[model samples]
Target: METVEFKGSHDPEKKIVVSLFWTVRKTIREEGCAPVHIKRIRTSRNVYEPEGRKLLKLSDDIMEDILRDMEMGNTVEFEMTMGTESLRVLIDDKRFSVEATRTPEIEKEIVEKLEHETSKLTPDFCQTFLPRIFPNQ
Candidate 1:
């Protein structure tokens, strides 16, 4: 069995984390794994103060957009606004902006099996296996 992992983080103020995991299974199966499974995790935290009511509203708006986009199978694009004191997330070309006294944190994780050739499986062999598993897309 073999495995690989990747991790990265962006600014804590608008904190973002991304991770990917790959694993090998079943030595008999060529490449150990015929296909890869992917999973993602995202987290956000916001703190509110008396004067930060507006910022809280913004956070809610952004979170809503993120959830909607995920349901629609879309990616999120992030931007800065209000002199970098605020953040914006775009979904399906629509943008939502928010301000917060304390920046919110965001994290994402993905785990999947990769069809990497071991001594038993070669790149040429994967060509035949991929089509059967991923017929379309």
Candidate 2:
């Protein structure tokens, strides 16, 4: 079970889990797998049991709820699985992490993808301005 993680604090807007979820959805699509379902959700207040125990697809609405929960100071954690590969997401206030139980190759791919996406979201201010002023001569 390999894992890749991202910290929300690093994000300028602190939307690390949002970016992580997008990456996960993209990875699932790229791997040609059907949409993954939420196996379970554990929140600070209570355990949310999805109707029928497995019908809850992780959608934008669910994400919104999670964000709302976080805003209210409730920690949210959930697990989604695709076959033998499972991804666990833990979000608390401004901190977030993901644990992926997948092949090393897949894990590395997720890390690279997350890094690339995060780079776009949080650009280095110094690097951006320094290059413009110095002009690589």
Instruction: Give the top-scoring candidate (lDDT).
Output: 2
Candidate lDDT values, in order: 0.27, 0.53
Specify the highest-TM-score model's number. Answer: 2
Tens digit per residue, CA lDDT, model 1, 1-137: 11222122221111111111111122122233333321111323222222432222224444455455545645454432322233333222221122222233211101222222211222113334333222231
Alpha carbon deviation, residue 86, candidate 2 (Å)? 1.5
TM-score per prediction, in order, is: 0.21, 0.55
lDDT value, residue 92 of candidate 2: 54
- 1-137 per-residue lDDT for model 2 (tens digits): 33344443453224534444554554565455555556777765556556875465444455556667877866687777765667776665644456676643555565556555554646222223222212241
User: Lowest lDDT 10-mer window, candidate 2?
Assistant: 126-135
Off by over 4 Å in 1: 1-58, 81-137
TM-score of 2: 0.55
State, as a TM-score between 0 and 1, how close model 1 is to the true structure.
Answer: 0.21
Cα RMSD (Å) between model 2 and the true structure? 11.3
